[model samples]
Every structure is written in structure tokens, then in C-alpha cells.
Target: MAKDNTTAGIIVRTYMVGALFLLVFYGVIFYNLTLYTEDRNSEKRLQLLSEYYSEKYDLADFDTIQIDPLLTIYGDYSNLPDTLSAQFSESWVGATTFHIDNDEEYSVLAQRIASASGNQTIYFVEAIGSVELDQVDIILFQSMLTGAGIFLFLIAAAYITRSARKIGGPISSLSNQLEASESDFSPINLSGHLPDETKQMLSSVNAYRARIKRALHREQLFTRYISHELRTPLTVIKGSLSVLRKSGNDKTLKHVGLMSTSVAEMEELTQTFLLLAREKLDRDVVAVDEQLVDRLLENFSGLIQRNEVHVTRVLSAPFSLDAHPQLFSAVINNLLKNAINCSLGGKVSIFLSPERIDVIDNGVGLGEKPRGYEGFGIGLKIVNDICDKYGWMFKLEPNPSRGCTATVLLK
Candidate 1:
């Protein structure tokens, strides 16, 4: 369900429960009050009827009102009190006989009063003349009311149960969907429109998916640069060697030299691709020897010489700490290569210290860092990653000269 609807449902159920409780209390109170008020009025009527009968019959001579006379004088006492009493009036008016009802209370009381007919009068009063039916009716009505209250209670319980299920089922479904979605995975299926929190979560999940997609896209482009563009030169190099066999002339040696150069270019491109491809390498932290960095840099000394870049070193004592060696090399090599490229054949300076290796190149200082474009051409990114993973620091800034200095601090 939608957030608004769920909230509304909860609010509605709360109000319903509140109203139901209030109504039940009111009903019970009113029913009891009706019984009490009716009883009180019945008592008053009994007294009044007794007096009326006394005046007519003048029964100081009678102790109880006869059933026939009571019914004739007061038509109904169904809503009256349970018992009645009065004093016998000796100076009462004449009545040769008294009327009576056939009901059990009236019959029993009538017999008692009649048998005691002397100078004494007997007064008898009762609610509904019939003891059994009045009690039975009250019991039955009360039972009906109890049943009604129980039914209403059950109805409220059912509504609450259903509402809880509605909310829980959707929330549980959303939790499962969230668990299934990963950083790279796309398009999580939330079966229906959910509440606000879930919708917000889905939006965030989608955003995360987009970031991964972009990373994957970048990786694809990186792969393409190696496989296709660089592969062409390697293919040309292979063709040149084969052509040398067929030509057997001065052209052969020239083609052989060209082939050698193409082979070198292919090797460099392969290294670059390999470096970029090491995304998940060194997932576990392991010690990396600092000497390894220096050694790796020495491998590129020949390139450094060819480019006329002065490589300076402050020989650092090698210390082993957590790192990914192959991935780390990508960072170093890229930075070194970029520095060399940007040097414009001016002295690309490289400095190695105890804590870090600095690659300084006299060039256009990263040209405003090339917005919306990021890679390891300058090699610092992979270096930065090494620092990030190892909890170290990597810095890149403009050199005092017209160049840029890239620093990678080892942990």
C-alpha cells in the first residue's frame, strides 16, 4: 500500500477502536441506568397504587391487595418494583369483594391476604405479578447484550489483524528485495508501489546501481582501448615479420625495425590494460615491501633515460605492510608514464623517499585536472587507490616550476 493509505488505515483503526470502546461503555452504562431508573419508577408506582387501592377498598382490614382487585385498579405492573407493602386501614371504603390475577405472585399473595381477613389488612406488591417471566426476560436481554459486545470485540480484533498483515507483508517484501540488490546489480523488483521509506530506499538503490554501471562502462572503454586500438599495431607487427620472409631485400630490415617498434607499443598497451583491469586484486590486506616499489621503478629506467627524465631517489629502507602488489604497480607505472608524457621531453623528475615516491613532471600541471575525465594516464589514481586501501595518503599538486608533482605515501 501507499504510505498515505497505510497511515490513514492506522489512524482509522485507532479511531475505530476508540469509538468502539466508548460506544460499548456508553451502551453498558445506559442499559444499567435504564434498569435502575425503571426500578425506581416501579417502586414509586407501587406505593401510589397501594395508596389508591387503600382509598377505594379502605383496607385497614386487609394486609395484602387481592390479585383481582390489584389488576383491575392498576392495569400493569410489569415495570414496577419486586415487592410492595402497606398498612391495613380499618376505616377504608366498602368493597364486598376484591379482584385478582391468576399469576403465581398474585395468587399466592391473594390467598395469604384472604385467609387473614379479620380486623387486619395485608398489603402485597410485586413487579410483573409473574416472578419467573420477569427474571427470565432480564436474563435473556442481558445475555443478548453480552453476545453483541463479544461480537463487536471480535470484529475489532479482526480489523486490527488484517491491517497488521497488510503492513507487514509489504514491508517484508521490500526487505527481501533490498537484500537481493547489490552495488552492481540493477533493477530491483518491488512488486508494487510501497510506502515512502521503501520508495526512498529503492531510489537510493537505483542510484547506487547507476554508479556501478558507470564504473563498468568505464572499464569497458578501458578494455576496448587495449583490445582493438592496440591490437591493430600488434597485428601489423606480425604481418611485417611475415612480409620480411617474402621480400628478402633492404625493405625487409626496415619492416623488421617497424615491427619491433610496433611490438614495443603492443607491450606497453598490454601493460596498461593489465593495470586497469586489476580492480578486485589484493582484496585481502597483505604486506607490500617498499623495495619492490623501487625495483619496479628501476625496470622503467630505460624509458626514463630515453625520455631524458631525471629519476632521483632517496633510498628508503624497505618496510613491509599491507598492499596489493600488481595493482600498486599500475598506480606507480601510470603516474610515471603520465609524468613522462606531460614532460614534453623536459626533465620529468622522479623522487623516492622513505614514506613516499614523488613523480614530478615539468608540464602544464594537469591542465585544470581535466573535468569529467579521470584515469590513470598520470598513474596517480591507482596510486591514490593504494593509499586509500592501505589507509595512506596520495597527493597531486602543481610543482614550483611549470609542472605537477604527484606523491604517493605508503602506510
Candidate 2:
């Protein structure tokens, strides 16, 4: 269940650790190589000095004595376990011997000088008497290389840490924002060149924020719709029940009729409210079936005739909508019913297009937003809400002749 970022962190940390490991191992190898090279060079220099002494002393005394080049190796050479012997030479005078691996030994260079020699013998003088510049240079070179490697590693680690923090900064900022408040449904306003993963997360968060904002707006409208729609029916129910209790003739029959009408209106309001809520106002999607719109219109045809209203319907052949048709039906039926009430036996014409549905009435037109009345009062607000929900453009303008035009467009 690990996230991609965590997996990436694990991989990167592993690589950096490996790099550090290799750097340390490489530093060790470099130190060993430097030490070995210095030791060998020092031994070569000692042998060269031995040759210098042999040439010097042999020429001074004509003694056929000389020191062997290998025997004069010097510079911390006391640890040489292979150079022990008791033999002395003509060109060597220091016949001091030492034990190597439990065997007595003398310096081979000294053995060569013991047979014959003068004060100029190469004895003890066979070793170097001074240090050389090359040795110092190599030592300094090794130190510089090691120090530079460490410095480079430190700089690289610093860069990595800085880069990681910089990339995670916005993510941390966004996390803080999420944990801060719930009612603050603002858009995520971050400014920076974000990494891809961070950008994707922000995109999802913003999408969720937008959806929640839409839901909240719809809920607010639902509250308003509830207040507006329930008032009339409740008033009717109260008045009707009161009249039935007082009157005596066919009072029961009268009360039943009024109460039945009131109950039906209340039920319609409740069902539509629930439907609007269930949609989550996400009726903003396409794929609305034309048959649903046709069925809704058919359902309300009876109401239009009951109100003494004439209809002129002209719909495009098989055109669909990206909205809820039941909601559309509520909108049109409310408008038509309002026109019927105003026209006193008038005509309501509905024209449908691929993108919009126009309900034009040659009667009482739009008075401002026209939401206050229209009798199916919740219907108008639901219509407007659904229009907003689906991004369907709405227009209410005066008809040049008479009445008003209500145009709802799906753009």
C-alpha cells in the first residue's frame, strides 16, 4: 500500500547511501595505493644511493669492495623480514648483524665492504641521509584528493536535501490548508513549478473542492426551495381542516378534495427536492435521453389543458440534452401554467433545438426573474438551479409582440 512518492524516496536514498559507501571504499583504496607507491619509490631511491656510495668508495681505495643495490634499501625498512644475513663485504664495514625469523644476519651491503675498505666505505652511508621533494609531493597530492572527495560529497548531499525540501514545500502547504478549515471552500491557489505527482494531487483536490462547492450551493437552494414550496400547501391544509371542522353539510367531501390537492402538491415538492438532491447537482453531464424529455412533456400535457391553455410544440427530431428532463418539465410546466393564469385562455408555444428549449408565451411575461410566482414556485428555482448545474445558458427577454420568451440553451 505504499505510495509512489515513498517508493521513489526509498530508491533515491538507497542510491545516495550506495554512493557514499563507494566513496568511502574508493578513499580507502586510494590511500592504500598511495602508501604502497611511496614505499616502493623510497626503496628505489635507497638503492640508487647505494650505487652512488659504491662508485665513490671503490674509486677512492681501489679495493674491489662494493655494496649490492638490493642490500641498501632504506626509509623505514627495519620491518623488512627478508634482508637478514651474517656475511660482510669488502666495501662495507659495519658488520653489525640482526636476527630475522630467528636467524642471525648482517647487512648484505656491509658484507660486501668488509673484505677490504678504508674510511670511505659505503657502510651505514648506504641509506639515504635526506628526504626528497617527490615523496612530499605525493603525500600532499593524496591528501588533496581525499579532501576534495569529501568536500564534493558534502556539497552534493546539501544540494539533494535542498532540492527535496523545495519540491515538498507546496505539498506541505496544501496539506496545511486542507487541515485548516472545512467551510473555506476556496480554490487551491498555489504558485510554483510543481512536480508531476504534486500537480496531479492538487488537480484532484481542486476537482473535489469544485464538486463540494456545487453541492453546498445546491443544498442552500434546497433549503430555500423547501421554505418556498411548503408554505402554500401547509397554509392550505390548515385552512381546509379548519373549514371542515366548522361546516356540516358535505364538509367531509370538501375537506377530502382540498386535502388531497394539498397532499399531492406537497408530495410533488418533496419528490422533486429529493431528486434534485440525489443528483448532487451533477446533472451537469451529457447523455440525457430525448425520450425522457418527451415523456415528461406528455405527463404535463393534461395540466396544460386543465388550465384552459393551448400548446404549440415544435421539437427537433431526436435531439438530446445534457440535463435532467424531469427538471426541465417542471420548468416548462410552471411557466406554461403561469401564462395560462395570466392569459385567461391563452397559448404556450414550446420550441426545441439541438442546444436549447424555448418556451414562449403570448401572455404575462417575465417580471424580473419571474421566480416569485408561477404557482409551481419551487419549480422555477429548480429550473434555474438545474440550468446553473448543467452550464445551460438561460435567457428571459420580452417578446416584441406580447408576453415573454424563456430560452434555456445547452452550450
Candidate 3:
């Protein structure tokens, strides 16, 4: 079952539990108070009857005297009813109420007198039909009280709901404002009627947004500066290499060719970095084909040769992806470079389909190599970031027999 985590739910539940406890508490107290009151009233009436009868009749004449219909007098303790006799057996001082054989309630009192005729015991018993009526009245009173408590509980529950909504309103508004302004880091605006605590929270959120905006501005400036500074050096090197190629001694020409390749790779890296630094990507449709793959492989030819890794490609069909060309190329380049570096003398296989690309390498599997091994860390981070921006799924797992498999789900 799902939990009720909302403010209104918590408030209502708390109020209901408290109200229920109060109702039980009040009911017990009411019932006990009614019973105690009735017991005291019954005892008082028995005491008054005992006093009135003791004055009206003499102890010697107690047996022969006419008894009142509401009262029963026992001149001897042995002549008393079994229920009343059992109560008087313990003491001859107090009054108590009990039921007779006919189930009629009686208030009984026992008195012992020291007289000239010898010691005598007398019992005065009175039937109290009012006790049954009192019981009915108590039931009715409790029922009324319970009904009133239930009504109050419902009112309290409604009040709690309104209170919860009132308490949660500002927070909900703030949340909606944040969601609406997701692409724009503007300060939130809310009604002035908010609580002091909520106002403080709003201030904190706006301050945090300002800090993030400033940090992003700094990052943008830094990336642009780096891109501009590096391009000048790369342009100068390309020009120098071209001049060296024109002069052409065979060894110098070969060296110029290598320098030209390195320069080209450097230019591509600069473009890739600039594209990745942007807050938003250019929505260009770039074709992922054998030509693009071959160009990326050429940039990593030195690594492939040094590692002695044989590379192969299996193209099910040509495909296109919605992404910036430089970003896409960077992703493919990094994944392939990492595979070659890890495979060292083994095979690196690339399987390309419309749906996904799988780069499987028969080399030391993940975790088998030490931390910070070549082709890990920064390379994988770049691939992951690009994949996330493009809304693609990327996974890396150890291969069954030997190396590791990195799969990028394009769809």
C-alpha cells in the first residue's frame, strides 16, 4: 500500500487518533462518575431509612411492629434473605445494594442493638426501582455524549483539512514556480501573505539560483577563451606543416605528414570540446556511416598500432541520429579509443545497427585492470555525458569469456 505522505493526510490522521483517544477517555470517566454517583445516592437513602425506622419502632417490638411496604425489617440476623444476610455477615455498620431472588435491586442496612432483652440484630431493606431507570438514563446520556463527540470529531477533521491546505499552500506554489521556471533561473515570486519561514526558504532558493547562474556564466567565458586561444596555435602549426611539405625532403616530408595528422586531430578535439561546453546542443541530423567511423578510427591509428589491436566493423545498415556532428563524433571516437587501449593485442569489434552500437573488446575485463587504467575515467565520462544529453542508453559489462562490452542504445 502506498503511504499517505502529504501534509493534509498527516494532519487529518493525527487529529483522528487524538479525537478517538479523547472520546474513549471521556466515556470511561462519564460511566464511572455516573456509577459512583448512583452508588452514593443509594447508600444515603438506605441510611435515612435506617434512622427513621430506628426511631419509630422499639427493638423488643421490631418483630411484631407493622412494616412499611417499601421497607423489610428483620428482627433476627438468621431471618434475613440469603443475599442480604451474606452482605451483613461481614459488618453490621454499612449499607449496600444487591439483587434479591426475584432480581429486584435492594438497598440493605444492618444494625445491632444492646438492649434490656439481650443483644438484637435488625436489617432494613428497601427496593430501589429508580436504579434501573437511572441505568437507562445513563445509557441515553452516554449515547448522546458519543453522538456529540462524533459530530465534534467530524468538525475538527474538516478544520484540520482546511488548516493543512492553508499551511501547505505556499510550499506548493513555490514548487510550481520552480517547475515552470526550469529553463530560466529567475527569482520566484509569491504572495506576501506567506509565513516567515516560507519567505526565508524562498530567499534561500533565489540566492542559490543566482549563484548557479553566475557559475555557468563563468564556465561559458572560460570555454570560449580556451577555444579561441588554442585555435591560433593549431592554425600556426597547420601553416608551418604545409610549408615543410612544400620543401619536401623524403624524411622531412614523412615527418610533416605525421605533424599534419596530429594537427588535424587537435583541431577536431577543439571542435568537440567547444560543442560539449554548450548548454544546449544544435539539433542537427548527422548520418552515422562507414565514412564517419573510418575518419574517427584514423585519428586513433597510432593508439591502435601501439596496442597491436585488430579492429573490425559490422554494419547492419546505415543510420542517422539527431545530435551535433562534433558531439556525435567525439562519442564514437572516445568509445573506439577506449576499446583499442583496453584490448592490447586482442580484437575490438564494432557492431552498428539502426537501434544501437556495440563495441566489444577482448581484453582485460572491467575491474580486472587497476584504477585509472588507460582509456577509462575521462574517456568514459565524456561518452556517458554525451549519451545522457542525447537521451541515449549506454552500458558497459564484462564479456562472458575475456574482455568488456560497451553498448550504446541509440533509440
Q: Comparing 1 and 2 by TM-score, which wins?
A: 1
Highest lDDT against the true fold, candidate: 3
Off by over 4 Å in 2: 1-262, 278-307, 368-378
What is the per-residue lDDT of model 2 for residues 1-411, given as tens digits with 9 covering 90 to 100? Answer: 654353335445765787789887987787667655544555555456566665565334342333553344322223223343223334334333232443322222332333234334333323221332344675687778878987988788777766766766787778778878566778786787888888889899989999998887888687667857786677777677677656745868665655655565565556566665653544443333456556655655555665567877776766555555456555665555555555545787877777777887777665633324335455557678767766787777889988878788867
Residue 153, model 1, lDDT:
70
TM-score per candidate, in order? Answer: 0.40, 0.39, 0.64
Candidate 3, after superposition: displacement of residue 289 in Å? 7.0
lDDT of 1: 0.58
Candidate closest to the true structure, highest TM-score: 3
- lDDT per prediction? 0.58, 0.60, 0.79
Worst 10 residues of 1 by lDDT: 106-115
Over 114-230, each residue of candidate 3 has an lDDT whose tens digit, in order, gives 777777767777767543455568789999999999998889889888998788778888888898987688788898488899999999999999998888788888888998999
What ordering of candidates by lDDT runs from best to worst?
Answer: 3, 2, 1
